[model samples]
Target: MERSQPNYRLIYHDIISIKCPGKKEECSPILNKKEISILDVIKLNMIIFGINDKETQIFNQKHRSYDESTILEILDYQAKNNLNNTQLANHFKLSRNTVAKWKKHFKNKHLHPVKAN
Candidate 1:
């Protein structure tokens, strides 16, 4: 079965008609049919809903990067609980390689505190 594309004209009308809360001016300009694309509608919807992909990605990455204290906590949990790399990764929502890398770094830091460079 073929899927029907969304009605861009109706979407454009709805978007242009939306009134900004507590403001008298129109929400946005009425775009010409030739000027509006699917991407433009998607961006307009995102703006209306306050959903920003770029900001979401930055927030996600910031939380994903483990801090020194978090790394130590992971190491301590692994050692005390006898969890394997895969288990630790699953429990913490991290990749197996990340878990292994943290374990290696923890060991290296304790064994060799001073680095040449």
Candidate 2:
């Protein structure tokens, strides 16, 4: 049986409050939210904290899933930036082997995109 896709929607409380000096302050529940893609989340992390080789190794220990669109975006970025497999892997904290496999897999799937398994 084929596996179902995972939910990538992430929600968090971004509460903003006002303070008063020695007076009963009034507060209201404000929901400030926006939908962000998982790829954007990963990009933000990389921007905020420059990932090192050790961190990349540790991150590689964890298994993460990416949809076809996301994979295509990554590969496109690699092409746009003129990055080799190793450089692209280091930038995204992915295994070089994984990058190579994705390149090979997608290249072969060009003619039969829907048949990628």
- How does model 1 score by TM-score? 0.40
For each candidate, the alpha-carbon lDDT, in order, equals 0.56, 0.55
Candidate 2 clash figure, as a count:
0
RMSD of 2: 9.4
The C-alpha TM-scores of every prediction are 0.40, 0.54
Per TM-score, the best of the predicted structures is 2
In model 1, the number of clashes is 0
lDDT of 1 by residue, 1-117 (tens): 976556766665565457433221232442444554443454454455555587774575456545565576666666666677887776755778877777667775433232111
List pairs with backbone clashes in candidate 2.
none
